[model samples]
Target: MTLNCLAVDDEPLALGLVCAFIEKTPFLKLTGRFSSAVEALQGLHTQQVDVLFLDIQMPDLTGLELARVLEKSGAQGQGPRIIFTTAFNHFALEGFRVDALDYLLKPFNYEEFLRSATKALTYFELIHKAETPMVQQAPQTQPIREDYLFLKVEYQLIRVAYSDILYIEGLKDYVKVHLLNESKPLLSLTSLKALEEKLPAERFMRVHRSFIVNLEKIGAIARNNIQIGSAHVPIGDQYKDVFSDYVSRWT
Candidate 1:
């Protein structure tokens, strides 16, 4: 199905660039464009936009803030999926926090855009298959799922299943990945931030600067620590609020 989509960016050039790119993609149809997210919210009431191209920062409502508002109001009626376009990288987690389907870092090329499009379609199909009779008429867009991810361990490429991973700890230059079936970690020379993008936000969360934990496994929790097996991961002060919402098993 051709995706009816909208674009919202303060920069006219950035907005125009996306419109030009959309003209070349057969599956995407540009339905509307807005410089302000507030206007886009108003447009949502009347237009049929299947996907949303959102900018990170704006005058009144930031893209991340707008996404949170949409999700809270459940405004994603027709799979008007969101893909955040941002200059800053720090808000990556916040993008996922609002369950953004994909994130396109600025200065991206057609290949990157194609990759994001494919991911969006994949999410749409998954939700389409799982929808109930009542809500099926509304857009059945699936959340993004990360299956197998790559990690370099020593001289070999280490493959880790999203479900198999328990948690990760970051050192100065290496990350130690603890798996469900293994005691020792599969080490990588990659940052926790880089690896965070490869996993589904719903399945995994960052509880600390040095630790990322899978929500499914929780042997225990004490104070600000998450327990998986015998290991304890400390929750960072900066991420405490976000992590607290998901650590309900312990709370």
Candidate 2:
């Protein structure tokens, strides 16, 4: 699938680099390009865009600041997939906190850009697929709630809101749920496999030998490791598919 995209940067060289990157990618369509985030924002209001190429340092509005405002003021909750191009690594975690697609440091090579773009496309594909509920032949559309899951805790069928689930742990046989509000994990006698079946594959994912994490709660992910709150989770060799699937789903 070719993704439509827009770009915003102040420097001519930077703008050229972004446009060139888009040109090299067969699956990316350069719908719009701008030297100002303000102008780009106006274009996005009318244009149907999938991805956004943003530069962090601008004259009046920083890329991060512009993205924050766009997220708050744009079409409901729909916002473009943002890839932040910056020279600083400090902003990487902050970018992810707002669900950024990828972090590309300045003076990025073509191979680096290609890899990031490829990963972004893969992420988008998986997310869109998972969020899509299987269509029943019944001529009626079933509304799929994208923000909640039901976990079986013992004999009790516990309903956990998506926002409340802190993170998931993979035990030898069972998975543990750490709630954002609760003092300790609301231990479930459910295996990770069983729990995963009930949960939305698009948002919740396995990351470690003992962890299946809520992507929303993730602070940052580097290599095969994820940082959720103060705890660090590993991505198991066997479960790398989980990370790949989750990333591909949305980026």
Please report how far candidate 1 places residue 117 from its true position, in Å.
1.0
Off by over 4 Å in 1: 77-79, 132-251
Model 2, global lDDT? 0.77
Model 1 weakest 10-residue run by lDDT: 125-134
Best model number under TM-score: 2
Residue range with the least summed lDDT across 10 consecutive positions in model 2: 150-159
Q: Write the per-residue lDDT of candidate 2 for residues 143-178, one digit (tens) a residue.
A: 645566655343223567878986888776556888
Badly placed stretches (over 4 Å) of model 2 are 74-76, 136-251
Clashes of 2: 9
Scored by lDDT, model 1 comes in at: 0.79
Candidate that would win on lDDT: 1
| Whole-model lDDT per candidate | 0.79, 0.77
